[model samples]
Target: MADSTSQPPRKLAPPRFIPPALSETAYPALKTGSGFVSRNVTVRAWGGDEKLSDTQRVQASGLAGCISGTTGGLMRGPRNILPGAFVFTLGGILGQLGLNKYLRHQAQQPAPGPQEPLTERILSSKWSPFSRLSDEKYIEIMEEKILRAEADIALIDDRISDLRLKIQERDQRASTDINK
Candidate 1:
């Protein structure tokens, strides 16, 4: 049997519904579509697509450079901003071109052979003072340097001897003149 103190269950209210009216939805859809179109147009104008040729890639890089320079100049405030932008734009183009050239050069170089011994690898590394120079080559280079130094020293000695002879001749003439 139910307890006499029990109360009846209460019913909850249903959720409110908002209708999708064209006036409310159309503006946002149009805004989003326009933004999408604008982005695509800007990217196309900048040659930013992946299928671009080398010339196109360079042009895109130049555009990127120009944008970067303009932003940098703006960040620095009003003084000489135009000049700064021009300088940075030029720098960016030249720097990117140089980087591309270096990368192409590196790509064209032959790949290294199979794994080398640890000692050989370490010795041949760019950080090593003896990079690419074998013991025989190092010795040959040192010998050449030594020969050059010796020749220079010989020339210096000859000059000193000639100066000494001139001094002796001058002193003898001075003494004879004094004795006269």
Candidate 2:
């Protein structure tokens, strides 16, 4: 009998539609002329090289429609609502533009290769705004600042005590002159 374990496992067929999560590859073979039309038809039609599945395209279309409808509704309101409407429309447009830019940037980034430890990834990521100083270094910096502040407070207290002493001496001299 043939040994099943000795034979290499067969490869599975590629899915008809690549999942949206997996479509962020360097080169994706997208469907060229899918007749499916929707609100985001313009964007989808022009995205010749980006592989977007039918569901994703539809979702994008729905989102675009919602934004357009909300903006249009706001624009048609009374004069009192004009300012609010303008702000709403402007914010919506800016948000959509920002989202597009972010998506494009993310797509351009290379996919993760071998898995690294979570701590290592977080420490190395450029997105973090915090300094990556060692614990000891951070403690030393804080201690130096605290010591400097304490010294300044001590100097101020000493100056205040000297002023109080001078005021007392002046009062005693005035009293002696008045008694004389």
Candidate 3:
């Protein structure tokens, strides 16, 4: 007979990511001309830099759009059409562009030419920026970036929750507004 107290161990695979909630007060802030675009860019850029596949990146982008639209739909004009899906698409595009910029920056670095100093010579230097930080520094910097991204993601979730509450409050007020 199988042991009643001991259960089969669950498998642990890749990490599951949950995005942050949108805030209600943020709706006006998000809907502002450049504010919305900047928010989308920030979210999508973080997604691109992380381990997410292209499909997942696309999904993140879409969610960003939906968050904006749904949060404001109640008070927005009929022509104030903000779509979650469309905004997500745009966000993804912007992320790709940012990624391309990084790639191009790397490619532009010159290869070791004959005129360049040899490894030993460069090592002997006392004032080189390259020598100041070792490979460990790069890893540390990367870790800091991941932490910031995680915080931003958490913010997104909080915003989303706030947005929901705002929607409910708005709904409650709508009847009075119409009657007035």
Tell me which of candidates 1 and 2 scores higher on lDDT. 1
lDDT of each: 0.66, 0.58, 0.62
- Stretches > 4 Å off in candidate 1: 1-50, 117-120, 123-180
Residue 42's lDDT within candidate 2 is 50
Give the Å shift of residue 150 in candidate 3. 68
Q: lDDT of model 2 at residue 86?
A: 48
Q: Give the per-residue lDDT of model 1 (tens digit) for 1-180.
A: 999999889897533222345536653444344434543554587655666655555555555555555544444445545765577557656766787788789989999789889989888788888667779999999999999999999999999999999999999999999999
lDDT for model 3 = 0.62
All candidates' TM-scores? 0.37, 0.34, 0.27
Better of 1 and 3 by TM-score: 1
In terms of lDDT, the best-performing candidate is 1
lDDT of 3 at 66: 55
Per residue, candidate 3 scores C-alpha lDDT tens digits across 1-180 of 989999899998533222224444555665453335654575567764366655555455455555555444433444445554356457655775576677768779987667645765676677654553578998999999999999999999999999999999999899789999
Q: What lDDT tens digits, residue by residue, belong to model 2 across residues 132-158?
A: 688999999999999999999999999
